[model samples]
Target: MLLQLCLLYVTIWLHSVSAQSSSIAKPGCLERCGTQPVPYPFGVGPGCSMERSFEINCNTSFNPPRAFLSILGGEIMGINPTNVRVNMPNLALSTYGQGARILTVVYGLSTTRYTFSDQNWLTAIGCDDMAAVTGLANRSFSGGCVSYCQSAGDSGGVASCPNDSNGFGLGTGCCRTPIPKGTTNLFVNLTDVHRNWRNNKLFSTSYAFVGEMVTSNFSYRLNDLNNATIFLSDNWSAKNTPPVVLDWKIGQQNCDEARRNLTTYACKANSECVNFDTNIVGYLCNCSKGYQGNPYLDPGCQDSDECADNPCDPNADCTNIPGSFICKCRKSYGGDGMKGGSGCTKLPPSTIINVSIDIDYTWASGKTEISSPSDTRPFISDIV
Candidate 1:
């Protein structure tokens, strides 16, 4: 009966704690843009987000709905505090172009809190194609990859280009390179590696793009390389674009500097400031340990009731405290009360121990007096 009462109390206390937690988004603003959560400092309307750069547009005209980064116009697939997953357009080049001109695509978010995360790769898919991805940071940086087919004939090794096990474009049908850190503006250039792309009847179109490292964004079959008609249809639609991960922070200032301006600082109570790992001048906010909730909202983070999970041994007593919990062995039980530790065990209350020691010391007489060893014995009980 006592254990049941304790469990009930814990459940009630946890519910209250969770109820006191603040909203992930702003108070009056809509919490979700379609299926994607529009959490601050990213919101869908005016005065909903921290600033213009963080605004998200919920386009309801689409069949289900779509969320887009207002500044970059990139379709948002998912969002968290530190990163956003999006699908940006792909750069398609035709084989008939030859050296006439190089097709290029550019995506810029240089003034916003978002940066191209290294989790994404600049990928090119085609036969006899070369592509280069460039980012403008402290300086102009570029990386390139090429994909080629040794022979276009059906009996050739073109069928073995993409790895059979995982369908990753290794070199024959697809090639990829990592994007540099702190990339805010991206540019991709696609060109025919050889002027004889028109001669290869197997491949008519090639594509270059930057996408997150995931199977949904990159996996392709041998037929995907041969069919130029696929890229011309809905296959290259906005919804079908490759996913890209972007790192985001609250402001273009370090944690120390942002903390000094409490009125304008993004972090609320029970939260801490964290700077971006890269040289990007910005900081992010996170709930402090033992707390959970949106760090960007007021009434900020709330205590996470660890005792609600019944982490202590069944025979032990659990006490909920601010930011932590305590466990103690029940009456007549021994050992630490933690479930993972030396849990409570049955022990007799009358348990005791006797010891003997010899003392050789004198009072003020400046002489050493030997004391009986038996009197120095101490008693210890319930030592499990």
Candidate 2:
């Protein structure tokens, strides 16, 4: 019985997946590079992508192969419709002197369909280190954080050092600040806070970089801080560098402006245009409500039959409409008929009746007296 139930669930899931419309690349375009799925608007070669800036290069030199952005020139670690995760280099400051060093990360995404997402945070990791990060993409933005010397066992300050494997930036040996939206070009400056900390062996190397909040992994360890060889090794570099998320859109114009030229508009039939809320001007296409498919392709998004999901009450009838569904009560029933609303109720019988009657009463005052004839009238009924 359990095996049968599991099989039934799998069959239902497969049917549901097959019913949904596809969002794939053009007929002749390459849809994937290595293991990365190069969906429509993003392709592997010429004539594959919607634009030149969306092109991706598949590097086969690696063991399992890797995908990189052709225009921006960064290894593509992960990708979705709205965001792309890339392997960003870290800003390392290695010196004994109590001085500051500046490192600039110029992504040069001004001419591309990409921008920095606000999901990233500017983080600095080291004892006795102060780091500031600035951006110059759509506007001028800056934020900084400071970290003090704190061991894994120390809990002296209000915010203690991260003792767990998952190191959280809490101002002790590590600190992090949020970066503003639409930041492509980044500048980071790392400064050694105290001169006396330079003499200490534990405070050797400092690291700073802009990394996505969810994927970054910079753990706190006293042994890692003391050893310079392990901190600067290739194995450490691969594990320490954080993934940066980049937001991509269809074009550099608003939905209204892009709609003026129908030939160049990205949104097709059965789809709507959504403008970006950032300082940059761009738009994205989405399938209309109750529809699923690629909005950028011909024949556009396909309407989904919501009634197939049995969204209506068991006693109600569900009708599939264009991009929507309607639910109504069955014959001899009334009410909204939806499962969430007042479900179908039985209607009253189609019949009417009326009746009239006369009554008499006697008054008793010392002796029984009969009621007046005019007072004894027929009473009409209200029910029908």
> Of the candidates shown, which would achieve the greatest lDDT relative to the real structure?
1
Q: In angstroms, how far off is 191's CA in candidate 1?
A: 2.1
Worst 10 residues of 1 by lDDT: 159-168
lDDT of 1: 0.74
Highest TM-score against the true fold, candidate? 1
The lDDT per prediction is 0.74, 0.73
| Cα lDDT of model 2 by residue, 18-125, tens digit | 544464777777667778887778788888889988888888898677888888777888878688998766664645454444444444567777778877777776
